[model samples]
Target: MAMGKTPGNRDDEGDEGVFAEINITPLTDIFLVLLIIFMVTSTVIVQQGPGGGAKAGLKVNLPKGGATDVTARSTDLSVAVLADGRYVLSGNVVTTDELKAAFDKARTENPETLVIVQADEGVPHGTVVQVMELAKKAGLAQLAIGVRDGE
Candidate 1:
């Protein structure tokens, strides 16, 4: 009889607002574990440097038979062919287009620059020719090859 609503019927907003609070304990634990792992791996990261990750301050004293007077010459460029025909030049694995670009840059710097090629022994000779051809196309005419000395 009263003007107020009936007891059974309720307003639409009777319940409190919906909420979602993420539990951060597990997340914090994961972050801490990752930090520890990185700290443990820092020693390995020290091995990388500009000289291509080569080790320094360590030497091996091996028995030497004799020394030869083959003077070491400077290289202006290099190329390589893997047994699977992978092509690499100037320390970078590159496509034919990239190889050409590198050769052009190297040749432009020094017209008489030497181009040294190092290929896997298992690779076919023809594959090496293809790399050399790319070098020639980019104006690198003076090319040298590296080989193993007889033991």
Candidate 2:
């Protein structure tokens, strides 16, 4: 009897039994290729999403200016002004009245909180100013307007 062959199996040349071993090198190679393709495609898709150049909650064309780069601290807050005059605080849509409360709550938690306003280029100047004033009234002294670094 062969070590890995069926007892009743025999070949014309007297070689018997089942091969019993699976060749998986080809299957492994195919799977690895597929994994690489998926990784590349996923990265490309993410890179092409809204605010591809930077991480932003809403899609906004920032005003171009000679702005310096600023590192955001953990205590920093983000507020976005949509083109349609809507406000999005930290990715959540909020009304003008709610904006004050949100900023107040954030300020109470961290007195040194910094507010970064990210308003679309098409947004009215008055709207942006209103949000800034609200933030100030909320006791958040540190305020910063988000802009794309003209690097």
Candidate 3:
């Protein structure tokens, strides 16, 4: 007989009707937890360097080294050996002949220019050596093999 009360329900006993409003406390808690998880994961990813601090278009798993960081000038040259048997001089893809030409040009401008060779872990030893030999032939006296920190 009471308004919003089911039939046969006793009026003497005070009983609230079915709850029409949704309880958002648990939903809000779940969302907050997910947000916290995303925040932590994103920070971790940002802190970790790609390829151990060597940023290049080509993916190269550099060998680990115990050597400390050496000072490099802005004019220093970087050569990357790709996994597909290709070469990257500075940031451009080039053939062996083209690489040699670039090296020659760089040497002409700066004879003491340092050449840093970065080769992927799966790259053949012969390929790396050939690159080094080309650098030497190009008149570059200072050559350094790039590697990730051992730590």
lDDT of each: 0.69, 0.83, 0.81
What does candidate 3's lDDT look like per residue over 20-56, in tens digits?
Answer: 4566888999999999999988766655756533243
lDDT of 1 by residue, 56-149 (tens): 3254443332324232356467677778888776566788788778888888888777777778879987888888887888888887666655
TM-score of each candidate structure, all chains considered together: 0.49, 0.54, 0.55
Winner of 1 and 2 under lDDT: 2
lDDT of 1: 0.69
Q: Which regions of candidate 3 fall more than 4 Å away from where they truly are?
A: 1-63
Looking at model 1, report the run of 10 residues with the lowest lDDT sum.
63-72
Which residue pairs clash within candidate 2? 5-17
Best by TM-score: 3
Question: If the candidates were sorted by their TM-score against the true structure, best first, what order would they fall in?
Answer: 3, 2, 1
Selected candidate, larger TM-score, 2 vs 3: 3
Model 2 lDDT tens row, 116-149:
8998979999998999999898899888888876
Error of 1 at 9 (Å): 99
As a whole number from 0 to 100, the lDDT of residue 55 in candidate 2 is 62
